[model samples]
Target: MKKNLFLTAIIIIVSIGTTKANSFKNNIYQEIKKDSARLSELDKFWTELSRTVREGDFEGYQAAYHPDAVLVIKQNRSISITEALDNWKQGFIDTKLGKKNDKVEFRLSKRIGSKTTAFETGIFYFTSTDSHGNPTEDYIHFEMLLVKRNEKWYALMENQKSEATKEEWKALE
Candidate 1:
């Protein structure tokens, strides 16, 4: 009887320890999985964003940013968006005349800082025409901040800088 009681207590203690260890392992596994899942979700946004740009769907392109967003250019031109119905009007004008933003190449690097927030580093290469009607290419290195709100991802801020000291910044209110 004494031997049986001792064995029973030993089994209970071992079982408890095993259960705790497994729980800890599962938690760590979940965290690693969450990180990968977050990256995948963030990557999906770029796919959609590229599609919108390629299609020249201005509205779709605008949808990528939150409403009341701000855009700054070259650290000199800053614009706050509020019911910006004709915000991209100038770009449209240039495109209509002769200038074209016809091609783009996106190289994206994403990092998941949290379950609801992420950051992206990317280089965007744009092909356009020079003054003499020749093909010219320019690239911009940009950093972006994004947040998941209402189960949807939206860009909270985007800033771009070039070697020529050209900077473009966008923020949301």
Candidate 2:
């Protein structure tokens, strides 16, 4: 009878451990699934932003920013995104008219936030051609605060921090 009782206790302990392991795995899987969905949505946000730049869709570019958005330049000054956009409008027009071409690419160093908010740190490579077809390229480090509303992501604040070297840009994931 003692032997039988020992075997029963062992079985119960093993069963409890197995159950706990399965629960842990399920929790990990759920976390991964949630994070994957977040990344997918964020990718759509970046894709639309890049498309607007490449296609010279000024309105679409403006739409990517929240109405109350702010732009911080090199940690020195802050201004309304609307004012910044106005300054940039002529470049969009020039690109649309085929007088110039502009392109931007991002490489992230860090991205963190919840389902409705994100703070992204990245290096942006911006290239533009002059009317004479001469290309100018710059690598800039930037951080942006974004919020999702109604299933759409918009930039709430953009900080164009500083210039980065090509080596620095390539070091990020």
Candidate 3:
């Protein structure tokens, strides 16, 4: 009889612990859902910015960037938003690349804060043919640190052109 009572007590304690754990998990899940919704909104803004880039709409892309934004190209180099825009414009003009088969796709990896900040990564695929009709592909990996400013999320810092592969993409998921 004593052994049975002890077993019952153990079961009761385990059940209570599981209930508490499940309650904590539910709270976390709800928080994550809220963050996901906010991230989705930010993702749309990022998508628009990418489309502007693909179309070579320098003005539109410039407008999306925060005035004091910094873009860090690999190797720890950083440039201001205006400088980056100028460089992009010059490159487009020099190459005469008129937005041929340019596409950008983004996926939300992880959201850190309460919709005030997010870490996102994505892939950009751009294709253009040379004078001899040779196909060219530019596949780039990009990451951005976004902050909510004036009720709008703006990318404060951006990093691009990392060695992006299919495996890396999968790992982000």
Candidate 4:
């Protein structure tokens, strides 16, 4: 009787452990699914953004930002989306689109967080290709806060810096 009781108790303990393990596994799976969905949605926005910027589509690029967005530079000055976009559109026209040898690439270099909000770090590379196909690259590195509103991801704020030390980047973080 004692041996049988001990055996039964062991079975019960093992069952509980197994149940807990399964629960934890399930929770992880659910989290993965949730993050996967969030990534898909965010990727859609980033793809559109990259294409717009790369092609120097000023109107499309302008549309990507939320009207209420605020952009901040390393100098700590803040500006409205409209003003920023206006400045950028003019720059794009003069510098990027008209030059046949100029090719632009934009990429979301890093990101963190979830469905509603995220911190995105991106790089925009402008390359000048010679007729021989040798290319020179200039890059803009930027970080921004993005929010999903009305089922669309919009840039809510941006902070741009040039050539910061590693410690400064950590401080910014």
Could you say which candidate leads in TM-score? 2
lDDT of 1 by residue, 1-173 (tens): 99999999999999999999999999999999999888888878887777654555566667778876665444555565433426654443454455555455566644647989887776766665534677766667766788888877888776664532124311110
RMSD of every candidate to native, in Å, equals: 6.4, 1.3, 4.9, 5.1
State which candidate, 2 or 3, has the greater lDDT: 2
Write model 4 residue lDDT over 1-173, tens digit each, in one string. Answer: 99999999999999999999999999999989988888888778777876666566777778778889998866569899888887777545643545535555545658787878888886655566544666776666678788888887888887774533444333444
- Candidate 3, residues 41-108, lDDT tens digits: the string is 88678778767756666666677778898998874688997788887775344343652434445654
TM-scores, in order shown? 0.65, 0.94, 0.66, 0.75
TM-score: model 4 vs. ground truth: 0.75
Q: If candidate 2 were superposed on the true structure by all CA atoms, what would the RMSD be?
A: 1.3
RMSD, candidate 4, Å: 5.1
Clashing pairs in 3: none
Runs in model 4 deviating more than 4 A are 92-109, 127-137, 164-173
Q: How do the residues 74-173 of candidate 2 rate in per-residue lDDT, one tens digit apiece?
A: 9999999999999999999998898999988888888898889999999989999989989999999999999999998999999999999999988985
Name the regions of candidate 1 deviating beyond 4 angstroms.
1-18, 72-78, 81-101, 129-133, 164-173
- Give the C-alpha lDDT of model 4: 0.73
- Cα lDDT of candidate 3 equals 0.71
Better of 3 and 4 by lDDT: 4
User: Best candidate, lDDT-wise?
Assistant: 2
